[model samples]
Target: MNQNSKISEDTIDLKELFFSLIAQWKIIALCVILSLICAMLYLRVTSDIYSVDAMVQLEESKGAASAALLGDLSKVTGGFGQKSPVDAEIEILRSRMVLGQVIHNLNLNLIVKDNSSGIMDKFLSQGRSRLTYQHDAVTFTNKQNSLIIKQLTIPEYYSDKPLILEFKDSNHFTFTYKDQVVFNGKLNQKNTSETNKGLWAVDINAQGELLKQSYTVSKLALPTAVKNFNAIYGVSEKGKMTGVIGLSYLGQDPEQITQILNNVLTVYHQQNIERKSLESKQTLVFLEKQLPELRKQLEDSEIKFNQFREKYKTVDVNAESELLLKQNIDLEKLKIELQQKQAELSAKYTNDHPLIRQIDAQISEINKKIADLNNRLTQLPETQRLYLQLYRDVKVNTELYTSLLNSYQQLKIANAGEIGNVRIIDTAVEPVHPIKPKKLIVLILSIFMGGFIGVLIALIRNLFQTGVKDSAQIENEFDLPVYATVPRSPIQETRMSILKKKKSIPILAVKHSDDIAIESLRSIRTAIHFALSSAKNNIIMISGPAPEVGKSFVSTNLATIFAQSNKRVLLIDADMRRGYMHKYFNLEVTPGLSELLSQQVSLEHVLHKTNVENLDVISRGKSPTNPSEMLSSTFFKELLETLSPLYDHIIIDTPPVLAVTDGIIISQYAGVNLMIARYAKSQMKELELSVNRFEQAGVKVNGFILNDIQRSSAGGGYNYAYAYTAQKDN
Candidate 1:
C-alpha cells in the first residue's frame, strides 16, 4: 500500500511538471514562429547547386599495344609498360594544373552572373539559354538567347567585382566601371585584356533579338579559379582494378557545369596523349639518325665484298667452308644488332634500367654465339677461312642494317600518328537536381533548436524571479490569513477601457460585475466582515507592502461588493500624493482628500457618487506641497472617523507601507486594516519589511489579499483554481 501510494504521488508530480510546461505555451509559440521565419528567409536567400558527372578510362591495353608497336625500340627505353597507380591518377585528375585547364577551356575564369534585381533573383526560375558563344563561336542565340560571354579578362583589382558590358546598339558596346564608362568598342571586336593599359578582347555575342541586352562579366585570378574548380571537382575510381574513373563537378548552372566537366576530361585525355606522344617522337629521332648510317654501312660492306672477290678471283670454297661461313654470318649479325640496341638503350636510359640490362644480356648471348662460330671456322684451310670470314662480315652487316631499317620505318609512322590510350567512357550531361542545401533537414533542426531555446529562457527567468507566488506563501510565511487570492482579469479591464476615452475614469465594478476577479472581491467581503465583526469602527484601510501591489484595486472592488450587499460603501482614495480614485469614479479630484485635509473643500463637495449601486467614492484630490504631512494631519484622521458613521463600510485606499508613513498614519484611523499583496509582483522581503514597519508603528494589519494571480507552471499555487475550472468544464 505504501509503495502504491508513492508511485501515485510520483505520477501526480509528473502531471504537475507537464502543467508547468503547458503554462509557458506562449514562450514556445514565439520561439517556433521566430525559427520558422528565419528558416523561410534562409530558403529564400540561398541558391541551389547542381552536379554533373563524366566517366573516363585510361586503357592499360592501349599502353601495352603502343609498346608492341615500338618492337625493338621498346627494349631500348624503359618508359613503356608502366601503368599509373589508380590513386595517383585520381590525384592528377584533381590537380591544380588539370582543373586550371578546365577553367581556362570553359572560360570559368570569366565570371558572368545576372545583377540581381534587389532580392528577386532567389525566387526566379533558371532556364536553358537559347544561344551560347565562345571564342568567337556563336551558338543558339537569337531571341531570349541573349549575349552570354565566352570569355572576359579583367585587371587584378576588378577580379571578383562586377563590370558592366552594356550594349548600346546592334554592334556598339560600352564597358562601364562604377557607373562610369571605361571604354567604348564594337560588338565582336572589344578589348579583352587583363591590363588597364591595353583593351580587353571580350568574346561575347548577341543576335537580332538580344542586340540591346546588357550583362556583367568578371575575371577571377588563376589560383582562385583553380581552388573553386577543385572544390567542385570530384574524382573516384569506379571499382577495384576496373581502370574506370568518374569525374564530377557541382555548380548553380547545369549548362555551365556540363561544359566545364567535358572540357576537363578533354584536357586530361589530351594531356595524356601528349605525354605518350613525346616518348615516341624521341625514339623516332634516334631511329631516324641510326637508319641512314646503317644503310650507308650496308652498302659499303657489299661493295667491299665485291672488291675482295674481284681481288682474289672469287675462289669457289669447299662445302664445309660455306657451312662455317653461314654460321659465322648469323652469329656476327646477332652481335652487331645487340651492340646497336645497347647504344640506343644507353642514350635513353641508365645502365641500371631494366630494358638496358636486358640489352646487355642479349649482347652477352651474341658474343657466346660468335665464339662458337669462331671455333668452327678454325677447322677450315687458311685461304678458305679468309674468304668465309669476309663473306660472313658482308652478309652479317647486310642483314643487321636491313632489320634496323624496317624497325626505324615503323617507329616513324607510329610517332607521326601518335595516339594515347585514354578513352572517354562517358561524357558529362546536364543534371536535373541540385546537390546542396538540404531544406527539410535544416527546417527540422531549426524546430528542435527553437524549442530548446524557449525552454532554456523559461528556466532562466524562473530561476531569477523575486516575486511572491500565492496565498499559501502569504499565510505560511507572514502568519497572516489570506482574505482572497485574485486571478488577473485583463478581459474585464479591457472591456472597461474600450468603453472609456483616454484620461477618463476606469470603473471595473460598474461594467464587469460578473468578472472572475470580482468574485474574489466577494470572498474578500465575507472575510473582512468576519474579521471586523468586533472592530471599533466600520472603516477599512486598504494598504500594501510596496507600490503597485494593487491596493486601490482590492479596495475599490471590495467596497463595491459590500455596496452590492445593500450596505452603503464609501471608497476613499487616501493616497494624497498619487491617488487615482477620481479617475476610477469619473469625478473631480480638487474637492477630495487633499482638498479636505488642506481645508480647500467642504466634505459635501469632496464626496462623489459612483456609477456602481450603493457605492460612493472620494478622490485623492490634487497634489500637495507636503503629502506626508497632509496624510499625518489630525484632520485626515477626523475625516475618516466622520465618514465611518455615514457609510455601512468605509474603505480607504492608502499608499504602500514601506514607501511612506501615509498608510501607517491612515491605518490608525481605521478599525480593520487589509494589506494587498500582488501575486508574482509583491516581493517576500518587501512584504516582511512592511509588516515590520506596521508592527513598529503599533498598528495591527488584520490580514492579506493576494491579487493578480497569473496562469502558468511557475504560478503553481494558482493551479488549483484552474484545475477546478477544468473539472467544471468536464
Candidate 2:
C-alpha cells in the first residue's frame, strides 16, 4: 500500500487546529491584556491636540467668448495652446509661488519647533560660574611657580543679601560686606640683576561678581542668560477621500495655537485673491493698448475709402466704356509680350530646365487672366454699371471698418471690468476634538499584531523541531498504521488525588479520567488492534524521534490495559541511558535490563511487580558504556525472545530512535514497532527520517502512537468518560 493510502483522506480538521491554539489561550489572553494596559497608559500620558481647517476655490479668469476666440485661433493656425481651465487651476493651487507666499507671510520656521527644551538648559543657569580653584602656590627648581586660586560667583539677580567671600584657608584672605577683598601673601622680591615684571591675577566674589582694577589693565565679566522655550506648529489628520481638512497646533499656551492658525488662514485667502487680480490687471493693460491701435486703423481706412469715392465722382457712360476697352487691351499686350519671351527661352533651352519652365508657366497664367478679363467685360451690362459697382465697393469697405472699431471698443471695456480668479470656499473653524492618538484603535491593532506575531513564531518553531508530533502526519508519509494515542496526565498533584481515592488492588483498575483527550486515545487504541489483524505475539515496541515524547507512559499504560484483560504483559524500560521505570514501579533500579544483557543476571531476576495484577516491569538496571552496542547485542535479542513466549503482550519503552539508533536496532526483534509522536512537539521530517532508518535496518514499523493530543470540545473525551463510568457501575 502507498504511504498516502495508509491514512484515510480527510479535510483538514480546523477544530483540531483551533484546539491547539486554544491550549495556548493563556498566551493569547496575556498579549491582549498587556496591549490594552499599554494603550491606556499611552492615552493618559499624551496631551490632547485640536485642529482647524480652511478651504479655497479657483475660478476661470476668461469667459466663454474668450474660450471661443482661442478655439477659433487654434483652428486657423492648426496648433494647440493653453491648458483647459480645470488643469490650469489645479497647477495654480500647487505652485511654489503660492506656497512661498504662505511661508513668507506666516514665518512658519518660527512657528514650527525643531527641538524640545534641552537637558543643559534645565540644569545650567546663566551668570553662575561652577569652576573651583585652590589658594596655594608651589615653586619649582626651574623658577616656575603655581598658585592655587578659588573662584565662586552667584548670579547678579540675588536679592537682599550682600555678597560674601569664603576661602578654604581662613588665614589666606579677609572679606568685607562691601564689594572688596584683602589678599594676604608673601611680598614680591625685587630683582637687582634684571627688571621685575608686575604679577597678574584674577579675583572672584561670592555674588558671582568679577572685578579687576589696575593702572595698566582692568577686566570685569558678567553672566547673561536667556530661557529656552519650545516652538509649536499646527497639524491635522483627515481621511484620504474626506473633503474635510484638519488643522492643529502645539504651543506652551493654547491661545497661541489658535491665533496662529487663524492668521495663517486669513493670509492664505487674501494672497490667493491678490494673485488672480494681478493676472487680470496684466491682461487689461495688453487689451487697452491694442484697442486704441485698432480704432486708429479703422478711422484711417474709412478716410482713405471716402477720398477715393469723392475723387472719382465724374461718371460718363462712353468714357467709362473706353477706359474698360483700354484696360483689356493693356492686359492682352502684356500676355503677348510674356508668350514671346517664353517662345524664345524654350527654343534655346530644354523644357525640363528651370528657366524654360518658369517662362512657359508664367506666359500661360498671363494669357488665362487676359482671357478671363475680356469675358467679364463682355458679360457686363455696360461701362456705366461697372462704375456703379466700384462706387458700392468703397461704401462696403467703409461700413466694415466702422463695425470692427465698435467691436474692439466693447472688448476693451469688458477686459477692464474683470475680477479676481480665486474665491474663498470655506473658512477655518476651531476643531471640537483631536484627530489623533486614537486609544481604542491603537489597542485593537496592538492586540491583532501581537497575536499574529505569536502564531507565526509558534508555527516557525514547530516547523524546525526535529521530533514527532501527530500520527496522521507519520502514517501519511510512511504508510503505517497508528497503534495508539496517549493523553498526557495532569501533573503529579492531580494524579495523586485519584490514586488516593481509588484504593484499588491494581492501580490500572483506577479508571482513567474521562477528559476529552483521554477518550480520543481509546479510539486510537481500537484502530491499532484492527491493524494488527493476525500477527502473532502482539509485542509492541514504542519509541519516539527524541526524548520526552511520553513513550514510557504509553508503554506502561498499554501493558496495564492488557493485564486488566487477564492477559499476561511485561512493560520493559529499555532506555538504559536514562531510565525511570524503577521509580514508577516502586523498585530499586539494580539488577535490571543492563545486568541481564551483560549476562550478570537472568531476566526473571530483574523483573518486578507493580501495583497492578498480571503486569510486570524490567527497569533499566544500571549505567553502561555504549548503550547502543549493548542493546544491539545477541544477548538482548535472546532476552526478548525468552520474554515474548512467556507473556501475552510485551511493551518496550525505548529511547528516541533519532537521538540514538538503538531503538531501530531493538525494533528488529519486536513483532510491532510503534513510533510515538508528541503533538506540537515533534516535527514531520524527523518522523519520516526515523521511519526510513527503520525500514533500511529491516525493521517493520507497524504503526505509530500519537501522544498528548489536546481536546477542543467536551464531546471529545465522552467515550473515555463513559467507559470509566460503566466500569464503576459494574
Candidate 3:
C-alpha cells in the first residue's frame, strides 16, 4: 500500500513538470514564429540562378585497326605499341591549338557595344551627326559650336599641308589649322604637324560622279567594360559527360548574349574538325616515306635470284645416275617431313622445342654432306657436277622480300583510307530547361536550419538560468519537501490608465482560479498551521535569500489569513533597508521599531491597525545605518519575547539573508523560521546558502514555503491540499 502511494506521488510530480513547461508556452511560441519569419525573409531576398546543359557523344577513331597491326609488328621487334583512340581524342579536345582557333574565329577580342537601349543610350548617341552635300562643302552644327567645311577629301595634295578651320558661336569665332587651334580671333593661321592633320581638304579637279562614303567612328571613347566568356565542361548525370557553355553580360542585353553563344559554338565545331584532320595528315606523311624502301628490297631480291640461276651450271639427272637420283628423292622426302614436323611443332611448342632441336641437327648434318659432295664434284670437273645450292638460297630470299613488299603496299593503302578515330555521334543541342536555383529545396533546407538554430539558442539560454522554474527541480536538487503553492495575482491597471485609454484588462481576480501566486500562499498557510500545531509557539519568521521576491507581501497576507480566524496576529517588517508594510497600510514608518526599542514609545503606539479586522502591522521604522547590529540587539529579542504572549500568531518579515545578516539574526529569535522561495525566481544555490547560514547559527528551520508555484499539478494542487487535510484530520 505504501509503495503504491509513493508511485502515485512520483507520477503527480511528473505531471507538474509538464504543467510548468506549459506556463512558458508563450516564450516558446514567440521563438517559433520569429524563426519562421526569418526563414521567409531570407527566401524572399535571394535570387534564383539557372544552369543549362548539352550532351555531345564522341566516336572511336577508324585508324585504330591498322595501328593495332603495326603495334603487333613493333612488339615483335621489342618496341612500344601505338596509343588507343580514346586517349588521343581526350588530349585533342583539351588542346590549346583547338581553343585558340575557336577564339580567333569568334572575334572574341573585338569589343562591340550592345545596340539595346539603356540608361546611357541618349548620352552615348548624342554627338553623332550625318550630313549630305550637293558639292564637297558641308556644315556641322551643335548647341555649343558650328563648323563650315569647304571641302573634304582623302590622300590629296592638301593632306600634306595644314588646312585652316574656324569654329563660330554667337559672339566669337575660334580659328584652327587642321585639328590644332591657332587663335580665337578672326583668320589666324598656325603651323601644324603632319600627324595632327584631319581628313578634310579641297581639290580643284573633280570627277563626274560625287564620291559617297560615310566614315563612322565613335565621337567619344568610353571606359572599357570587359566580360569573360568561356565554355565550361564537366561530368553530368546518366553516366555521360556534359557541358554548360553560357554567355552573360552585366548591362541587360539579351540579344548580345544570344549572338555571342551562337558565334562561339560555330567556331568551336570548326576547330574540332580541323584538329582531327591534322592528325590524319600526319599519318599520311609517315606512310609515304616507308612504301618505296619495301618495294626496292622486293625487286633486288628477285634480280639476285635470276642472276644466281644463270651463273650456276645445273642439268636434269634422271636414270643415268641412280645413286644421285636416290639422294635427291631422299632430300625431297626429308624436306616434306621437316615441313610437316614444323607445322605440328608450331602449334604445340615455341622455337626452343625438342622437335626444332632435332630438325636443326639434321639440317646441319645434311649441309655438311652436301659440302662434301660439292668438293668431290669440283674435283671431277665442271661437266661431271650436276648439283647446285646457290639458286635455293636466292629463292628463299626472293619469297620473303615479295611478302614484305606486299605488306608495305597494303599498309600504304590502309593509311590512305584512314579517317579520324574520333567522330561526334551527337552534337550539343540548345537546352530547354534551366538546371539550378531550386526554390523548394532551398526553402525546406532553410526551415530546417532555422529550427535547429532556434533549439540550440534555447538550450544555451536554459543552461544559464539559475531560478527555480519548477518544484521538481527544487526537490531533485535540494531533496526538500514543497509545503504549498500559491497562484499569482492578476495585475491591476490604474483607473487613470483605464479611463484615458478605455483598455480592458485581460484577466481579473477570482476566488477560485488556478492563479500561481495565490495558490502558493495558501499552501504556505497550511504548512504554517501544521508546523505550529506541533510546536510550543506559533511565532514564524518569513524570509528569503533576495529582495523583491514577494517575501513581505507573503508575510502580511499570511497574517491576514490567521487574523481572519479571530486569532490575534502581529505582522512585523523586520527588513530595515526597504520595509514596505507601513507604506502598504498607509502609515508612518518612523516611531515604530526604533522608538519601541529605545523605550521612548510603547509597543501599542507603534502597532498600526490595517483595513482588515484583527490584523495589525509593526513597521521597520526609520532607516538605520547599522541594521545588522540593531537586528541582533538584546532589545529586539526582548520585543519579540513581549509580542510572543500578546498574539496568537506573530509573522515577522525579514530582509533577504544573502543581502545581510539581519534576517538570519532575527530568525534566531523567532520560534520557527520558514524560508520563502519564489517560483521561477529564487535559485537553488541561494536557498542552500540560506539554509546553511541558519544551520551554522545553530537555528533550526521549520520548513520551506514554496512561494509563487505555478497553479498546476506539479505545484501541489488540489491533491496536495487533500493530502494535507487528511493528515491534519488524522
Candidate 4:
C-alpha cells in the first residue's frame, strides 16, 4: 500500500526476515525445550520393543504328488504362477488357526501385571510384569499377599477403570475401590455374575488355585488372542523367487517374541506334515478296498486248479510249462503295478510327463517278458498247457496280492514319516537389544518439530497484524518527510514512567540533555525552523493518527528544547476532551484552554509559566461535552491570534486526528500541522488517512515524527545507538 512496503514486495528483504526471526528467539527456545521434555517423557514411559525373527525355506518338492493336500499357496498370499506356492505357505503361517494353536500351547492369552500404584505407569507398561504369574506356590512367597484378582473381565463400560482386589482370606476376596466392596468371589472356582458395567466370568488358574498371591490375571478371548498374535507375526520372502521366507515378531520381552516366532514355525511345520500325508491316506483307503477282491480271486483260482488236478488224475507239466507259469505270474504283477502308477500320475500330469513315460517303459519291458513266456508255453502238451494256464492264473493272483500288500506296508511307513516341505533355516534367538525408540532420531526430530511450530506461530501473528514495523514506510505512504526518528530514551524511561504513574510528566530536555530522544528533538527543532520560515505564523499544531502515540510527549519535549535554545514558546493542550500538559510542570489543569476558549478566565489567568525559561504551558482546562463545537468556536482562533505576537512558537497538542474533528478544525489555524507516529504501534494506512484529513481541511501536513524507535540487535534494522557510537568512536 505504501511505497516503502511496495518496495519490499518486489524483492524479499532478507535482513528484515532474519531480524524478525532473531527477535523471537525466546519463542523458538521455549518450543524446543517443551518438545525435548515431552520427548524424554515419551522415551521413559514407552516400553522397548525387541525383534525376534526366524527364517524358513519353502523348498519346492521335486515329485511330491501331494496336490490333493497342499494346493497352490499363491492364492492365499497374493502372486501368480511360481510365486504362489510360497506365498500360500506364508499366509498359512500367519493364519488364525496356526496362531491360535501357538497361543494356546504357550498360554499367551493369560495376561497378568501389577497395577496397584499409579495409573499411567501400569496402563502404558509393556515391560516385565512386577507380579510373576505361577502355576504352583513353591516358586514364590504367599504369606504377604494383599490382593489377588485370580480372574477378571472388563466390559465396554468399565474397560477403562481398574479392579482393586482386596484379599480377605486364601479362598475369598472382594473387588473394591477405596475400601468398599464392589463384588465378592471365592478363589479357584469359576463364577459368572453381573455388575454395573456388564456380565463377567472368571476362574483362578487350575494349577495355582490353592495358592494365595497378590496379583491380577486375565484370560483373553480366543479370537482376540489370535488377532493379537497375528498383528505381531510377519512373514515375507527374503528376495524375489528365493523361496526364503523371513518370519518375525517384535515385542517388549525378548523371551516372549522368541517363543512366539518359534511356536509359529513349529505349528506351520506340523500342519505341513499332516497336509503331505493326506494324499497317502486317500490312496491307502483305495488300495485297501481292492485287497479283498484280490484275495477272493486267488482262492477261486486255487480251488479250480485243485479240482482240475483231481479230474485229470495227476496230469504232468513239463519244466517249460512251470517256467512259463512262473514267468507269467511275475510279468502280470509288474504290469498291474505299472497300470496303477499310470493312473496315479494321470491325475496331476499330462500323458507326456516324465513319470508317465517312465511307467510306460516299465510296462513295455514286462510285456516283453510275458511274450517270451507265452512262446515257451506253446511248446508244452495241451493237457500240461491247460494245467499251466490254471496254475498261471493262481500264481498271478497270489503274486499280485503279495506285491500290493508289500506296497501298502511301504506307503504306510512313508505316510507315517512325512515331514513338511518347509525347513527352518534359522530359529529365532532372544534379542540382546531393543529395536524401537531410537533416542538420537527422536531428539533430532523433536528439535525440527519445535522450529516448525515456532515459524507457524510467527506467521499466524504476522497475518493478523496491521501495524507498521518500519519508520520509512510512514514517510513513503503519507507523502511526509520524517523530521526525526526518536530512539527510545532509556535514561528518562524509568523516571518518566514513575511521573506518569504519579499523574505527572518528566521533562527529558532538562533531566537528560544528551539523551537520544532529546538529541532527536533538537533535530526536529532545526527541521521545523527551516520548514516554517515562510509561514504566516509560528503557531504549530501537533497531533497523531491515534491516541497514545506520544503526541503530548512530542509537544512538551520539543517546546522545552526550543525554549532552552532561548526562543519563547507556549505548549497548549488543546485536546479539551482529554489533555494533560500541566502534568509536565507543577500547575493546575483549570484556568487553562477551556476557560480561555469559553471566556470564563482571562488570558493571563489561563497561561502558566513553567520551570523552564522562555517556556509556558496551557493545559486542557476541563472536559467538555461538545469538544468539536468548542474547538471550532471563534474564541479559540481569537485567543491564538492574540498570543501570536508574544511567542516565537505556539505549539498546540490536539487529540488524535482520525478519532475526532478537534485536530482537523484546529489544524486550519496553525502554520504547519505535525503528526507523531509511534514505531510498530501505528499503521501506514492510519498515517495516510490522518494526513489526508489535514489536506482536505485546507492545511498541508508538514511531516511526521517516528517516535519511540526501539533498539534492535546489532546488524539488525535501525539500531541508532550502535550506529551513533560507531561513528563517534571513528
Candidate 5:
C-alpha cells in the first residue's frame, strides 16, 4: 500500500510539473522569439565558405626518361622498374618547393585590403575578394574599389608587417611604415626607394576617395605563406595504390580558392616534368662520357685487328676458330652490359641487396663463359689465336659503342618529350555555391535549441516552487482535513478587474449566487455548522500562512453563503494593517474595527448592514501601527463576544499568521480557527509552520480551506463546480 501511494504521489508530481510549464507559456514564447532573432543575426553576420577541388593521376611508368633507357633492359633483366609512390607525390604536392612557386606566381603572399571598410561593411559584402564601396566624390566602378597593385617587393625584415598607403588623390599615394613616411609616388608607375630599414618597390592604381580611404599592404614570409596554404589545402590518394591524387582548398572567396588550387596543380605538374628532365640529363652525361672511351677502344681494336690480318694473312682457316672468336666477343659484350647494370643498381641499393647481388652473379657467370671461350681460342695455333683475340676485341668494342650510342640517341629524344608521370585529370573551377552556414538547418536547430532552453527554465522554476498543489497532499502531510476546495471563479476575477479600474468591487456570492466558488463556500457552510456544534462560540477565524492566499475572499464569501441560508452572518475585517473589506460593501473605513477596538466608536455604530438581506460588515478602519497589540487586547475579544450573539455566525478575516501575531491573537477569541492555502501558491512548509504556531499558542486550527485552485487533469486535487448546466428561462 505504501509503495502504491508512493507511485501515485510521483505521478501527481509529474502532472503538476507539466501543468506548470503550460502556466509559463508566455516566458517560453519570449525566449523562443529572442532565440530566432539571434539566429537570424548570426546567419547575417557570419560569412559563407566555399570549397574548390581538382584531381590528378599518376602514370604507371617510371617516367619517359627512365623508360627509354631501361625499358628493354628491364625485359632482359626479368622486369625490374620503379614507379613513384602516391603518398610521396602527395607530400610533394604540399611541399614548400611546390607551393612556394605557386604562391609567388599568384602573388599570394602580398596581402592587400581596404582599411576604410568597417566590419559591418565587410560582413555585408559576402566575403568578396575586392572591396567595392563609394564615399562622397569617390568613383567606384563595376570592378569595385579599384586599388590595383601591379608589383610589390619587400625585404625579409618587413614580412607580415603592415604598411599603410594613404592616397593623396586618385593617381597618387604616400607610403608609410611604422608611422614614418617612406616614400610618395604616383599611380601607373613603379616606385622604388631605399629607406633606413630596407628597399621598397611598389606600383599601384586607385580610383576611390583618396583622402577619405586608405589601404594596407603586408607581404607574408615565404614559409609563413606556405604554412598558411597548407592549413587551407588538402590532398590525398583517391584509392589504395591507385596513384590518383585529389586536391582541395577552402576559402571565403570562390574565385580565389579556385585560382589557388589551379595554380598549385600547375606548379606541381611543372616540377614533376623538371624532375624527370633532370634525371635524363644526369643519365645523358654518364653515357656521353662513356661514349668517347668506347669509340677510342673500338678504333684501336680495329687497327690491331687489321694489322694482325695483314701480318697473318687471314689466319682463320677453320669454322671452329671463327665460332670461338664470335662466342668470346658475345660473352665479353654481355659482361660489359651486366657491369653497367650493376653500377646503376649499386647507386640505388647496397651491394648486399637482391638486385645488386643478382647483377653481380650474372656478371660472374658471363666472365666464366668468356674465360672458357678464351681457353677454347688458346687451343688453336698461335697465329690463329692472335687473330682470334684481336677479332674478339673489335667485335666487343664495336657492339659496346653501338649499344651506348643507340641508348644515348633514344634518351635525348625521350628527354625532349618528357612530360612527367603526373597528368591533370581535372582542373578546379569557380564554385557556384558556398558550403557553409546552411540557413535552413541553422534556423531549425535554433528553434529546437530555444524550445529546449525554455522547457529547461520552466522545469527549473517548477523544481524550486516547493508549493502544495493537491489538498490530499496537504491533508496527508499535515494530518488535517480540508473543509472545502474553493476553485478559481471567473466572477471573482471580473470583480477584481473592475476594482483595478477604480470601480466598485462586486460581491461574488450575492451577484453570482450560482458561481462555482459560491457552491464551494456552501460546502464550507455545511462543514462550519458541524464544527460550531462543539465550539466555544459561533465565531470563525480565517487566516493564511502568507498574504494574498485569498483568506479574505473565503471569509467574505462564506459569510454570504451563511446569510443566504437564513442565518445572520457578520463579516469583520479584523486586520488593521492593510485590509480592503470596506470596498466589498462600499462602506466607509472609519468607525469600524480599529475604531471599535480603540473604543472610539460604539458597537451599534460600527455595525453596518450590507445589501445582502442577512449579512452585516465591519471594515478594517484606518491601518494602525499597533494592530497586533489592538487585536490581542481584551476589547477585541469582547467585540467578537458582543457580535457572536447578534448573528448566527461571525467570520473574522485576519492578517497572515507568519507575517504578524494578529491572526494568532484573533484566533484565541474564535470558536474555530482555519488556515486558507492557495493552490500552487502557498508552500507546504509555510502552512506547517503556521499550524505549529497556532498549536504553540494554545489554539488548534480546526481545518484548512484550499483556495483559488486551478483544476487540471491530474486526479488527486479537488475543486467544486456545477455538474450540470442550468436551464435557461424559455
Candidate 6:
C-alpha cells in the first residue's frame, strides 16, 4: 500500500510538470524561432570550404638503376629492398623544405583584399575568395575596387601591416600606411621609394574603378604564412605499412587549393629524386679518387715488366713456373679486390661492426691463399721466379684498374638516371563542391537543441514555483480541509472585463447557474451549511494570505450561491481601504461599512439591495484614517449582532491577513473563519504564516477555499472541466 501510494505521487508530479510546460508553450516556441534565425544567419556568414587531395605511394625498393650501379657494393648498402618507412616519408612531405618551397612558388606570403565598406558588400563577400585572381601574383578588382600586385617587398618590421593602395587613375596610384601617404607611383612600372619608416618596392597593374575604390595589401612573415598554410594541410598513409599516402587541403577557392596541392606533390617528387641521387654521387666521388692511382700503378707495373724482360734478355720460364705465376696473379687480384672493398666499407662502419668484421674475415682467408701461391712461386728457378713475379704484378694491376674504371662510369650513369622511390598515383583536381556547412544537418540539430533548451527552461520554472498548485496538497500539508477547488470562470473574467471598462459585474451564480465555478461554490455552500449548524452565529469571515488571492470574489460569489438557495444573505465588504466590492452590484463605496461602523449612518441607510433576489450588499465606505480602531469598537460588534439574526447567512470580505490586523480582528466576530488561497499564486509559506497569525490570535480557521484555478494547476484525473456556452443542453 505504501509503495503504491509513492508511485501514485510520482505519477501525479510528472503529470503536473507536463501540464506546466503546456501552460508555457509560447516560451518554447519563441526559443525555437530564435534558434532557427540564428542557424540561418550562421549558414549565410560561414564560408564554404572546398577540399583538394592527392594520392601517392612509397616504393619499398630503391631504384633499379641505383642498385645495378652499386653492383657488388649493393651488398654493403642494403640493396634495392631498402627504403624509408612510410611514417618517416609522411613527415618529410610536411617538412619546411618541402612546404616552404610550395609557399614561395605560390607567393602565399602576400595577402590582397577588396576594400568593401558597405554591409551588403561584406555580407556577399563571406563565401568568396579574398582575391579575384591568383597565380604567379594576386589580383583583385570589381566595379568599385581594383588592385593587382606583381611584386611587393617590405622590411621585417613592416610585415603583416596593412597598406592601402588608392589609385588616382588607371596609370597612377598612391600607397598609404596609417593614413599617411608613403609612396606615389605609376601602374605597370616598378616603383621603389624609401620613407622614414622603411623602404617600399612594388610593381602593379590596375584597371576598372581604379579611382572609385582602394585595396588593402598586407605582407605576412614567411614563417607565419607557412604556419597558416599548414593549418589546412593534411597528409597520412591510407593504412599501416601500405605506403599509400593521402594529402588534402581546405580553402575557399577551388582552383587555388587544387593548384597548391598539385604543386606540393611536384615539389616533393623533385626533392625525392635529388635525395636518391645524392647517394650515387657520393659513391662516384670515392671511386674517381681510386681511378687515377690505379691507372698510374698499372703503368708502372707494365714498365717494370718490360724492363725486367730487357735486363734478363731471352728469359724463359718452365711450364710449372708459368702455372705458379698465373696462380699467384689470380690470388693477388682477389686479395686486392677484398682490400678495396674493406676500405670502402670502413668509411661507413666501424671495424667492430658485423658487416665489417665479416669482410675482414673474408680478406684474411684471401691473404692466406695469396701467401701459399707466393711460396709456390718461390720454389721456381731464380731467374724464372723473378720473371714470373713481374708477370703477376702486371696482370694484377691491369685487372684492378679496369674493374675500378668500369665501376666509376656505372655510378655516373646511375646518378644521372636516378629517380626517387615515390610515385604520384593521382593529382589533385578542382573540387566541384564544398565539404562543410551541411545545411540540413545543422538546421535539424538546431531544432532539437532549441527545443531541449526550452523544455529545460520550463522545467526550471516549474521547479522554482513555490505556490500551492494542488488542493489536496494544502489539505495534507496544513491539515486544513479545502472545501472546494474553484476553477477560473469565463463569466467571472467577462465581469472583470466589464468592471475594467467601468461597468457593473453580473453576479456569477445567478447568470451562470450551471458554470463549473458556480458548481464548486455550491460545494462550499454545503460545507458552510454544516459548519453553521454548530456556530455561535450565522456569519462567515473570508480573508487570504495576501491581496489578489480572490478572497473578495469568493466571498461575494459564495454569498450569491447561498442566496440562490432561498436563504436571505448579506455580503459586507469590511475592508476599509482599497475595497471595491460595491462595483459588483453597481453601488457606491461610501455610506456602507465605514459609515455604519463610525455611527455616521444608520443601518437602513448603509444597506443596499442587489439585483440578485434575497441578497443585500454593503460596500466598504470611503477611505478612513482609523479603520482598525473603528472595526474593533463595540459599535461594530453590536452592528454585526444586530444584522446577523436578520440574515440566514452573512459573509464578510476582509483585508489580507498578512497585510493588516483587520482580518484577524474581524475573525473574532464571525462564527466561521475561512482563508482563500489562489492557485499558483498563494505560496505555501505565506499561507502557513497567515494561519499561524490567526492561531496566535486564538481564532481557528474553519477551512480553506482554493480559488481561481487554471487547467495546469489541476493535475489530470481530478481536474474539473466546464462547458462555456450559452446554449442549453438537450
> Number of the top candidate by lDDT?
6
Q: Backbone clashes in each candidate structure, one number apiece?
A: 7, 16, 20, 2, 0, 0
Of candidate 4, the 10-residue stretch with the lowest lDDT total is 721-730
Q: Estimate each model's TM-score.
A: 0.78, 0.47, 0.50, 0.70, 0.80, 0.78
139-195: candidate 2 lDDT, tens digit per residue: 111112122222222222231224332333422333223555332222232112111
Candidate 2 matches the true fold with a TM-score of 0.47
Q: Show pairs that collide, candidate 5.
A: none
Task: List runs of model 4 lying over 4 Å from the truth.
Answer: 1-11, 37-47, 63-84, 106-185, 192-201, 205-228, 279-327, 335-386, 389-418, 467-478, 485-523, 556-573, 576-651, 678-685, 707-730
> Which predicted model would earn the best TM-score?
5
In candidate 5, what are the lDDT values of residues 375-464, reduced to their tens digit? 777888788778778877898898889988888899899999998888999999999998888888988888888888899898787667
Please report, in order, the local distance difference test score of every candidate based on alpha carbons. 0.70, 0.53, 0.51, 0.71, 0.78, 0.79
Model 6 Cα shift for residue 240 (angstroms): 2.9
Which candidate, 3 or 5, would have the higher lDDT against the true structure? 5
Q: Locate the minimum summed-lDDT window of 10 residues in model 2.
A: 721-730
lDDT of each residue in 1-730, candidate 3, tens digit only: 2454446545545454444445444455566677667656554443333333333344444343234324344332233223334334444434445434443443333221212323454335454322312222333333233233332333233322343432253333333445665334321222222333344222221111111111111111111111133333332223423322222221122233334334434554566454434433443344344346545644665576566546664455434344543454355434433433343234435779765676667666766765655454455334334233333333433443454345446555554554543333333334433343456666666666655665555545544654775555555555566665554443321231342233221222132234444444555666677778887676788888887666765676667667766888888887777775675566777777766766678888998887767878888888877878877788888888878888889998888889899888987777778877776578878998988999999887776666554435533433232111000000
Q: Write the per-residue lDDT of candidate 4 for residues 595-657, one digit (tens) a residue.
A: 777788888887888899999888888887887888898887888898999999999999988
Ranking by lDDT: 6, 5, 4, 1, 2, 3
Taking every candidate in turn, the Cα RMSD to the unseen true structure, in Å, is 6.3, 21.6, 17.4, 8.3, 6.3, 6.0
Distance from true position, residue 269, model 4, in Å? 2.3
